[model samples]
Target chain A: MRIGIYGFGSIGRLVAREAVKRGWEIVGAIDIDEKIIGKDIGEILGFEEKYGVVVSRDVEELIDADVVVHATSSYLDKVYDQILSLVRLGIDTVSTCETLSYPYYRYPVLARKLNEEALRYGVTVLGTGINPGFLLDTLPIVLTAPFNIVEKIVAKRSLDASKRRKSFVEKIGIGMDPEEYMKALREGKLTGHVGYAESVYLIADAAGIHLDKVEERQEPIIADKDMIIGEFKVRKGEVIGIKGYGTGYKNRKEIIRLEFHAYLGAKEYEEIMVIGTDYEVRWRSTGTPGDQGTVAVVLNIANIINDLSPGLLLMTDIIPFKPFFKH
Target chain B: MRIGIYGFGSIGRLVAREAVKRGWEIVGAIDIDEKIIGKDIGEILGFEEKYGVVVSRDVEELIDADVVVHATSSYLDKVYDQILSLVRLGIDTVSTCETLSYPYYRYPVLARKLNEEALRYGVTVLGTGINPGFLLDTLPIVLTAPFNIVEKIVAKRSLDASKRRKSFVEKIGIGMDPEEYMKALREGKLTGHVGYAESVYLIADAAGIHLDKVEERQEPIIADKDMIIGEFKVRKGEVIGIKGYGTGYKNRKEIIRLEFHAYLGAKEYEEIMVIGTDYEVRWRSTGTPGDQGTVAVVLNIANIINDLSPGLLLMTDIIPFKPFFKH
Candidate 1:
């Protein structure tokens, strides 16, 4: 299979490396960055070996590729043109964009347009990863199939931001004081996280429930002692982390609760509880890494794109995600 | 769809009732019980109306039925001849037998023969229920599809036996003295709940891991206080319940742990934890009634049976179970 890569960043490079390991041909790569525009794909990714495929700023170069693995940005609005260009060129795509995970819930207009364009060009497009795609939302909906009825659902995911990317720490306002953190949060410079609300909406939609209201809240986790994380230092009596929650309401009752917490040294785990009529179910996993989980999910579902019908599809529409075991 | 019910017991009656409500035709009913023979199905089930169907002692009466819903027995060995007769007659079957959930693990020869007969007659046979089929095993295996690599799996289910069947109370030896309960357990009068071992085997197979050893252990849950359930009374310090666990090991490392606890007034819930290379996943459900859950699953997967290939199949081999929402 010939593959092109969009968003030549850490996740994109990981996808390329995995594809190469599977003996898939790296047809081309597209990135808007100027510094590595003409560099060899392997060299741009810091590998000593070269694959002879140069990075190009043009999407046309990737028209010959069978599928494109996209990890460019977080939202569908941001990557709309880039994805539309590839879909028009008749290329299948698997992306890690969080909002695109279930765009039909929040961005129906754009999602419909993308679906129609993909159908016209006879291509398939999917948005998936670990967080919004699996941990808090899609997994819970699928787990409720055994029950006669489900009344409520609560899903919680906690992360230790110290072990995560630098961007995560900055986004959470880790090193800032309470006043500064509050100021950034109000100004929208620091939003809690991208996928909590999306996860809530995805669950509500997948379970066929209509929520009258969807709400979000954020708070700070105060630091008790000094801490140090790769080049970043945190002082005592400051904002050490952030906790965010998104809830969906129906008939004045909160039916879905999605809680996410990321702190300097917080416990790392994910938990989902589904309250059903015949059964109430809960699932939890400890010590799951963020990057590895998302990247692995993206690469695992890449090959499944072409088999799917053209549309802005959620994880539910495709074959359930399976482990990519190499024989 | 022309449906024939074999067993004419509580579960079989439930399946027939559900199928009737869905507008399916009840072609015939089969049972060896003398008391229910020659009785109209509706009259036997205490319904005001008759459906013009009568119970018969011969399996041959069900040859014209499109499918058979079997729920008369628990062990595959006890139901082997009954199931083989249906397969030879070229009728598809869905049963609630625990051992048939994953018969290949403990009954390889019988499983192979059933598969061969099913293939020759172009019919499909499946065993499923709330315990071995869903809460403990199949749900966890299906939930793990989003991971890249899984290292270990742990599933636990606890039931409030007081709210369950009278058969469950007897099976767990509730209200019995420790000595008497042990004697019954040892004499095969009351074996531990039948599905924990099957659950472990199913998960191991679905994960593509070969377990070197699979073991089960059971102990009595002694009553701490006097309790009254239905007509059974439990005294303090007496046997009130049973706890059973099945574990699978590979190269001396415990890989799969399935624990089940059932007692009078025990806290009821189900939990599953999957520890993978990139993520650890957990799911739990509380207050699930066993009979209701099993009936719901059977009805939900009924349409999928005719679409599957002719063979002895697992829940994982078919389209994952989905809710049967009426439009």
Candidate 2:
């Protein structure tokens, strides 16, 4: 299979390496960054061996590829035109866009438009990643299959912001005081975090719960002691991170609750607890690299893109992803 | 939807209740038991409300129903004629037969024949339950979606036979001495317990692992102290239950391991652990009622029977089941 790597950033590079491992030809890379444009893709991703593939700013170069592994942006609006162009060119796509995870609930018009375009071009478009797609929604829903009656779902994801990329740390309002964080929130610079509400909404939809209300609350994780993370130092009492919760309610009872925390000293682990009529299930993982998981889900979904029907699809709408390396 | 029920045993009655709850009409039931032949199913199942349905001995009585929930026997051969009759009558079926979970691996001819019959009649036939279908294979495969490279999978299901029905306890050779159990095994009255090897093969198939050899070993779980389970009693050094392991290997390396134990004092829990290149994950359920889980999975699959294509299908071949209750 010939594949294109869109948005040659961290996740894009990850997908490219996986594609190569699958013996797929990396036809081209699309990125607008001037510094990396025209550079050997392997070198840009810190590989000493040259792959003979260079990053290109021209999207037209990807037209010949069978599919594109898109890791461009979390917001569907930003990458809408690019995704449409790929579908129109008859290239299937598997993206890591958060909003596209279940866009119909939040972006009905865009979701419908994408589905129509995908059907028109006879291609499949999917949005998937570790968080919005897997960890919080699809995984938990799948876990509950063995139980007869599932009454409630609770999922918690805790990540140490200091261990994450600088962009991710800043995005979560780390190192920001109450006033500064509020300013960013009001200015719309710090918009919706990826998985909080999406997870709750998707779970509600899957369990057939007509959620009467969805609620979100965010609070700062204040530093109790001085901490230093790669030349970024924070004094005691300063905000080191953020903790957010999203809950979906049915008939005034909270049926889906998601807790997320990313902080300098956050205990790093992920867990999901499900309460059923006959049994309760819990899933946990420690030392799971966030970036690797996000990239892995995208690559896994890419392998099955052709097996799905044409449309804007959610992770649950497709067949469950199997291990890609089926040997 | 009008539904006919076959087997009219524990799982059959369970499916009837679920179907009724879904507002499906119980048109008729087919069972060989003379005692319940003309009895109202609701009364036999301990319900005060009359369902206006009676059990019949004739398989022809099931022709008018939209589907049949068959839970008669564990072995596919024992239930083959019955299943074929249902398919010939143009009634779709969801069965609890273990070998039927992935019959192609062990019964190629029968599997093909069933598929042809199902197609000829434009109906679908599926075998699914908590054990062979969900907990051991599909659940673990679905859990590995976030990992890029999965090296191994280990699942452990420990059940306390004392907590289960008498039929389940006797099926596991509980309270049987070595000589008695061996005689039963040789007589074919005590066949292999369901789900262990079938789970391994299904997981191997779903993960794309071609096993060079699949191994199974069963040993006695002896009672160290006197234990009483209802009216059944076991003395010290007597066989309390059974412990079985099914392992699938590729290139002489173990890729899937399933350990099952059902003994008097066994700790009750279900867990699946996966070793991935980046990280490992664990899923656990405490005090999970096996009977309840089995009944739930069958009912869940029944809801989606028409959503799938016509065939003698394995659990992995169809879409993963979802929570079916819409209210």
Candidate 3:
């Protein structure tokens, strides 16, 4: 298989590394980083041997591949043109964009346009990752397969912020006053997490249930005692990280709830509870690596995206959740 | 969609109930039970009204259905002719026979013949249930999606026989002399469980790894103290139930291990641990209903069997475990 890597950041590099191990040809590398442009892909990947492919700003560099993995940004607006440009070139794309996981949830107009363009050009497109893509939505849908009916769903993903890298920890507004963190978050100066609504709708849509209400919020998880977390010193009643949640309702009855948590010294694991009439099952995971899991999801979908129907599709569209779909 | 039920036992009735809830048309019911034959399915199901379809010994009753769920016996030898007769009538089938999950494991010749016949008649045939199908095999494959390289896998399904029906508890040889239970089990008078080898092979096939050795064993779980279980009285040193295991080795190194425990007081849950190089993750589930899960597996696969290629397939074949396949 021949593949290309777009947006050569942490995730893109991870994909390239795993792809090479599979013996797939890395046809091209597309990135806007001025520092890496014009360098051999092998050098940027820290390999002693240089691959013929070079990191280039031109999208055409990826035109020769069977599929181009677009891992640009979280929001749809930020990566809209980049993904469309690839679609215009008639290339199948398995992107890591969080919003694109459920484009219609927040970008109905753009999603429709992208779908039309994909159909016109005859290429497939998908957006997925560990959170909006699997842990929160896809896994829950799979768990509901054994039930004749599903009444409600609750999922929580908790990862220790102290274990994450510096850039990822910074986004959660670590080690700040709880009130100040909320104020900055309200003013749009900080970004806690994204794709809560996407996951809520993804689960509901797969269940074929229409939601009357969907709401999301992010809050600070204050440390209760003096302790050390990474480089942070002792403190009490201070913001350590954030806990975000999304809730969906049907006819004023709660149907779905998803929680995303990342805090210093937090327990790292994911739990999903799916309840049916007189039945309930909980599926828990021994935490997943965010960036590593993103690489896996993107490449796994890339392996089969070419065989799927052409259009802008969600992860649930091709994951084969037929049992829930029947409901 | 129209469907048919080939066995009117516990699983068949469960499937019929859920299928009706989906509003599917239950075209016919076929069974060899002399007492139930010729009776209206609805009446036998304890419904207030009668369904026109009647239980019969003839396969023609299922000819009109888009798919037929064949849930008679566990071993392939017992149900091969039954399934082939349906395939001859150009009807797709989803069977709950445990041995048929990986037909080639114990019946390679029969598996190959069934595949040829399925292709000749252009229909899909699948064998699936909770143990051989999902909990031990399919679910583990799905959990391996995030890893770059997997080294070993261990899955366990532990259920409390005390909470199960009497018939189920009887099969586990509850309250029997440990020595007598072992002798009876060896002499074929008692059947504890089947499908360990099938699950091992299914996992191996998805990971694209060939096994050098596969071994399975069933041992009695002796009671440690006197206690009441259901209607039976167990004393210390008596057999409470059984603990079965299957292990697969590659090049003298163990690669897969699966344990199935059904004892009077066993903890009720399922757990799967997949370890990759420098990475490991565990997925656990609250206890799943064996019979209900079988019904779900059959119907879920039946829902999409028509769209699949014509042949005998395993759960791994359709569940989409590309990440593992890449290995």
Candidate 4:
């Protein structure tokens, strides 16, 4: 399959490398930066040029490819117009964009617009990645396989986010004034991603439960003392980490627990648990260095686009309980 | 202590009888029903007159007591002003009124106003009962005792409503059209108890977690066959039960799950579970006929009023996990 990758930054470049290794053809790469455009994709990631495909600034120039892989940053509010453009061109698309995964939960009107556009174009659109997509959607479904009678489902993904990008660190209010961090949180400006509620909604849909309410909550950085990160000294009242949690309840009973935590320079772990009438199942996995799990999820799904059903799908709709690739 | 029982209904009469048995002085009883005014409290509950306390429709006259126990029905919106009036009169009060437990969660502005009035009057105001107040508040704290490291807390209270009052049966949508029930649920009009969110919030506060988000959800009643009760025949599409759930998440992690379920003519059961680092503790209690558990909680707390700290308190704030009265 000839694929075009939009946003040829870190994750996008990694996806390109993985796709090449899997024998998929890279038609071209699209990036917003003019300097990066027309450059060999391998050269951007410090690899010797092998595939002759050059990065293009023009999105329309890459529309002829069989699939468009969107590995853009978390600034998804701006990407909707581009995705809609692709939909208008009748191009099949898959995104690792955080907000688009479950747009309806956060950006309801935009999500609806995207869904309608995708349907109108008759092309499938999918949003999948580590946190919102996999933990919320895929993990819950995997945990429920053994239980014919599921009483509740709780999934938690905790990350030592110090190794993450600077954007992530700032978004979670790490190494910032606690009061300011809290103010941003209350205003919803600091919500790093928007799919926590969407994930709960997707799981409830899969579980055959019609929920009357859905709620999301966050835990701000409550640091005992301040420390320095990247040359800036944070004070005692400053935040060094933050946690976000979303839950779905059945009949005023908690049926699903979706939690996400990111800490500056800490150990990372992910767990998914389901409570049922007969038994309970839990899956815990450690994240690789530098948020490699995020890269792995994107690549894993990229390799199986053919096997997946057409249309917009969440992570739970695609991820398998067992690891996708055997060592 | 001189105490007046307001709203001489089932719960109020039960409180009066229990108080009489404990040798506590019953100042009087009050109800909205004019027909019941001036009647002996004993005659209201089919018992012989012994306390010489008469039931009256005059709420103002009843507020003269040192304490007034408000055990009114669910129409708290109508009585909130009256309750506030009594609180302003400097009466130390305990209420089983459904909406009083967490006025902040349900009616925030009113709860705050009442709180201010109670503080200004130097009087204590408390709301307590079996389900929303005790099961959600006291039970969670009790379950957390064994675990030094609590990762999450989940509480579930399920009751078979066959033995419930006629008002409860109608409110829960038992023997009602399912479509209409669902419509009411969507409109938020069918929310039977608004205190579920308050219960979760109170528990979260006790746990010392600053919750970023709290969400509530409900489930529709689904039955494969029609249910017949008395002269009312509920179709399969009609709701026979309802479930309400509230969850509090800290740092995007699931920390507390509070749930309540009511069914018409149903068996009663309550369970509290605390998931901690070292161990998980679960307590399940079954009720005898006529919601004896509800009476137990009220009577237990009343017996220890002298031992309690001098202030307003919820069921959890006053009642110890141990037996109220040793056998």
Q: Largest lDDT belongs to which candidate?
A: 3
Candidate 4 Cα outliers beyond 4 Å, as residue runs: A73-77, A186-189, A226-234, A288-291, A306-309, A316-327, B1-327
* Candidate 2 lDDT score relative to the true structure: 0.79
- The whole-model C-alpha lDDT of candidate 4 against the native structure comes to 0.64
Write down the C-alpha DockQ for each prediction: 0.22, 0.35, 0.53, 0.01
Error of 3 at B190 (Å): 3.0
List all candidate RMSDs to the true structure. Answer: 7.2, 5.1, 2.5, 23.0
State interface RMSD in Å for all models: 10.8, 10.3, 2.3, 22.5
All candidates in order of lDDT, best leading: 3, 2, 1, 4
Candidate 2 TM-score over all chains jointly: 0.94
lDDT of 4 by residue, A1-327 (tens): 677888888778877775665467888788888888788877877776556878888888777678888877554577887777777877778787777776666677877777777777787777766655655576456434333345777777667655667666777877767778778878867865456787887787655467768888777766666666544466777677777777876677777778877775555655666564534545444432323445445544554454445566665444222111001
Q: Candidate 3 vs candidate 4: which has greater lDDT? A: 3
Q: Which stretches of candidate 3 lie over 4 Å from their true place?
A: A176-180, A183-189, A223-227, A234-238, A323-327, B323-327
Residues B187-280 of candidate 2 have per-residue lDDT tens digits of 7677546767888988877766668898887777787888787566899878888888899888778888998888886888888887876578
Question: How do the residues A243-276 of candidate 2 rate in per-residue lDDT, one tens digit apiece?
Answer: 8898988777887889888888677878888787
Colliding residue pairs in candidate 3: none
Model 1 - which docking category? incorrect
